[model samples]
Target: MKEELSLVIAFDATSDAFAAEDVFRQNGLSGRLIPLPESISAGCGLAWRAESNLEKELTDALKSIDITSAHIYYLIL
Candidate 1:
């Protein structure tokens, strides 16, 4: 399979993660909520996986929703 570079954003709570998901979807940003990978941890059990290029878009979306403490990780998945 072709390797896709993804930005993994994790939060401290499911609500925060879901909130981010909603904003991104509503704004046409690209990403999806997924189970927290074994590779990273942020106290929350959920995370978001998005294309690398969408990092800024994700950030902006989070800003619109007032979500913070989201750790961003870039990796091939």
Candidate 2:
């Protein structure tokens, strides 16, 4: 098996993380909650990981949910 790049969204707070999750769910987006990678920094230790190809969908969902406190990153996992 080999690693692949994924979309990682680090949240500034747990509320924001949950919000993102809800938004993704409501929008039929694909992703899961994961621990924030050590390579990234944020107020919350939780993050949403998704396929890199879903970047646009994820961002749009986040926007609809008014989650502006997330830091988006692309990391190999």
Candidate 3:
């Protein structure tokens, strides 16, 4: 299988991660909650994974949830 460059948003804490999940779910956004990639340990052990192009929208969603601090990374996985 081939991996593609993806957008992975790592939250600073579990609450932020869950909040993001909730916001995304309620808004019918794309992406899923995933274990933080081993290559990334910037924040909590949870991350949001989606197409790279979705970064802006995801960031906005996080903002809607009052998550102003998150680590955004582009990784191939």
Worst 10 residues of 1 by lDDT: 35-44
Spell out the clash pairs found in candidate 3: none
Q: Per-residue lDDT for 1-77 in model 2, tens only?
A: 78999999998888899988998999999889999988897343899999999988898888887887778899999
How does each model score on TM-score? 0.88, 0.89, 0.88
Displacement of the residue 47 alpha carbon in candidate 2, Å = 0.5
Off by over 4 Å in 1: 42-44
* Collision pairs in model 2: none
| TM-score, predicted candidate 2 vs. hidden true structure | 0.89
* Clashes per candidate (backbone, < 3 Å): 0, 0, 0
Give the poorly placed runs of model 2, Cα more than 4 Å off.
42-44
Local error of candidate 2 at 73, Å?
Answer: 0.5
**Which rank order by lDDT, best down to worst?**
2, 3, 1
lDDT of 1 by residue, 1-77 (tens): 88888899988778999898889999998778888988796443988998888887889889888887899998788
Candidate 3 local lDDT, residue 23: 91
lDDT of 3 by residue, 29-57 (tens): 88888999888974438999988898778
Ranking by TM-score: 2, 3, 1
